[model samples]
Target: MVPTMVLVADGTRDTRRKEALHDLAEAVADRREAPVQAAFGSPTELRAAVESIEGPLVVVPAFLAGSDAASTELLAGLDLDSRFDACATAPLGAVPSIVAQLVTRLHAEGWRPGDGVVLAADGGPELPGNSERRQVIDVARMLSRRVQTPVQVGYLHAWAPSVSDAVARLRRNGHDRVAVATWQLVDGADLHRLREIGATAVTAPFGPSPVVIDTLLAQHRAATARLAA
Candidate 1:
């Protein structure tokens, strides 16, 4: 059997918030036939969760790329040579799996062939070419070719051509209706930024699409399989 592992998150105490994490954990566990332990709450809780699972383990962050202090500490603890043979996967940025999910969400939301899709991320000089921004660009470029829509890149924080700028340009170019597919997992900072830019239609993290769940599970399974090998 695959060695025991745990999924750790800083965790929101809100029941609604835990629902998504629990669902993804269960899906990954089912696919790999490995027991999964969830550790949520304070740093102590997270540490305990990591300790519970024996042997080599992986830390899969639910967050997008950012300078999260708590997350940084957790990663530092796991990155040490001893303790665990830990590898940190990029926090669900614009990996192929996520891009596929986003594209599907666009289609489900009635985005027509000519609709403009702007891939927006938390871009700023502070986080220039950060993992999240890079992944969004990659996803948008690939999606542009696949969807035949004008996919543009914009940033909410530190990057140029902000969503407002993109929107103005798109409107000026006669693309009146634009859909902002937030390249973010959950609605918080990124969502707020989207609102600030006056995004009328914003796609949900993964849009409640079944494929998003499956893609996340596949990522978990593939990561575990690589570790086992």
Candidate 2:
């Protein structure tokens, strides 16, 4: 039986964010020619989809991993639901192509040397690994190394060095053009706030990008193959 794919994301009431998730699901559905559902922060929807599955079920985390408050918690609840046999894939942030996507977006937006770059993210997992949250910071470093420029970090919700502060610091550092590499899969209040803060430019979120959709599909296919095994 062909496994139905479920894309799980950090749920939000924002219409644009919801639409972004649906759009991504539709794109992957079209390419894989398979049934796919987007359960954005809805345990009821996820359970319903799982309980109704005819075959194997594959859960793909559409948001970045290490977001314990979001993806991790959601997955934990799935373990408790136990409505069906399911195979899951790491969150989209685990995809190695993500770095490439960031670099591509940076260059596409006409970023150049002497311009400041900030990896503006929602927040990091609080449970501990490194107090400073290594996931987003590591990503920032990866972006920095690839672009051959220093990359600053700004957390939208939780931690310090807010995107606003990062932008301000860049201004003080003599960077007239500051670009924020928004580390989100969908557009919502966070993106809106990042935009309002006076960054010279903000790279688009990953949602509608083909690279993201393709990576999601790859993750689903891999999980499906695992279930078959």
Each prediction's number of clashing residue pairs: 4, 0
Q: Could you give candidate 1's per-residue lDDT for residues 73-177 as a string of tens digits?
A: 454455335554555555555556567777777777667777777877655443323455566677778778778877887776556788788877777787767
Query: For model 2, what is the alpha-carbon lDDT of residue 223?
Result: 78
Least accurate 10 contiguous residues by lDDT in model 1 = 66-75
Task: Report each candidate's C-alpha RMSD, comma-separated, in the order given.
Answer: 4.0, 2.8
Clashing pairs in 1: 123-158, 123-159, 124-158, 124-159
103-187: candidate 2 lDDT, tens digit per residue: 7888888888778999887765465332336677778888888888899988776678888999899889988999999888776
TM-score per candidate, in order? 0.73, 0.87
After superposing candidate 1 on the true structure, give the runs of residues whose Cα lies further than 4 Å from its correct spot.
8-19, 30-32, 39-45, 63-80, 93-97, 124-130, 187-196, 207-210
